[model samples]
Target: MARMATHMITGAGSGIGAAVARRLHERGDELVLLARDAGRAKELAGAFPGARTLVGDLANPDRLSWAFSHQPLPDRIDSLVHSAGVVDLGPVGELTTRAWRGQLEVNLIAPAELTRLFLPQLRTARGHVVFVNSGAGLNAHAEWSAYAASKHGLKALADSLRAEEHGNGVRVTSVYPGRTASPMQAKVHSQEGKEYDASRWIDPESVATAILASIDLPRDAEVNDLTVRPGH
Candidate 1:
């Protein structure tokens, strides 16, 4: 039998994570879906035969470590997609330490820890690491201090990792996708008159397609940073 490509995807419960999981599943890749919610993880696993699920809050290092240690380790991880993130929008003065830390934990720290833990497997597979970052990382906006800071940190982390792994054959691609149609956005724009047309936002499937394209590129070709936005 042919060997299946192993993939670990964070935030696989919904949004771009789920879309990417589906895309890989269609290609016969074995998936490990990690999320905070067990029910959602099980639901996604049910949709894709042989796709395993890991339920844990990535913000907690103990939880993340325990899950991976107990679960079956993949022979090699062909792709590591960091789509998990949290957005807490508020004026700088109103942003509490707890809230800011929470955003950083999920958006930046967790992914970094995961990358550190799985670096060996990725190196063995000559795999690609994909960071689903945001345009906010490049451009700051009012009332988005925490979110912007976390994304900026993530972008820096990804860039630095790419440079460090230049000769190791592990490629890192930071994708800055603007305004996706996800529950996160709905929560962000829930206030009156700030309603966003989720239908008009970028499709998660399209982002998934782009991710797959990057991964499928020849080893000699690398797309370090890809920016995508809705065409509206």
Candidate 2:
């Protein structure tokens, strides 16, 4: 039997991250889940025996440092799936400094730091780095300036990593998923004062399945970017 590879996923407590965790677990992959909410993370771990859970808020610099430093490692981690993110909706004129800063910290800076921490292992394993970006990462939509800016930053970060790490055999993939049916989307819908329409959004499970397919690609092939949107 082939050795089961380990993957670390941030934001595994809910939404797309949670869905990916479940899918990986079902497929018998070793998992390390990092979620800010200790209680929720622990609860999720109960369903996946042998899976590891780390509690750290992605926005907290101290926690970010602690989470990476404290974790035990194998010679290499097969992949690091960056699924944690925050969404803020507003026109550029209405965007607050705090909101803008918070979004950038979690969406951009945290992932970069985590990637840096895992770079050596990733290089050793020739592993893949998957970023769960937003449709906003591709273009700015009305009333989503802050969120779009942060995701745009994330897209650039992924692009740069792919170029810089190509020689080391590391593959970087950015998944731009549009309006997935998730708690974050529900919150955005509430903010817009519109009826939450689950039917109009892509399901998190479907995105998780696609992510799995990306990872399963033959070593000779690389999927640099994947954009998933609602069919309707």
Among these predicted structures, which one has the highest lDDT? 2
**Backbone clash count, each prediction separately:** 0, 0
| Model 1 Cα lDDT, one tens digit per residue, 1-232 | 9778889998777789889988888878889888577677778678777888777787785567777787677768889999988888888988899989999999999999889989999999999999999999899889888989999999999999999987889999999999899988887887323967889899988888888889889888998899998988
Query: Candidate 2 overall Cα lDDT vs. reference?
Result: 0.88
Worst 10 residues of 2 by lDDT: 66-75
**The CA-based lDDT of model 1 is what?**
0.87
Clashing pairs in 2: none
Model 2 lDDT tens row, 1-232: 8888889898777789889989989889899887677686778689678898776688874467767566665567788999999887887888889999999999999999889877998998899999999999999989988889889999999999999999999989999998999899999999898999888899999999889888889999999999998888
Evaluate residue 104 in candidate 2 and report its C-alpha lDDT on the 0 to 100 scale. Answer: 91
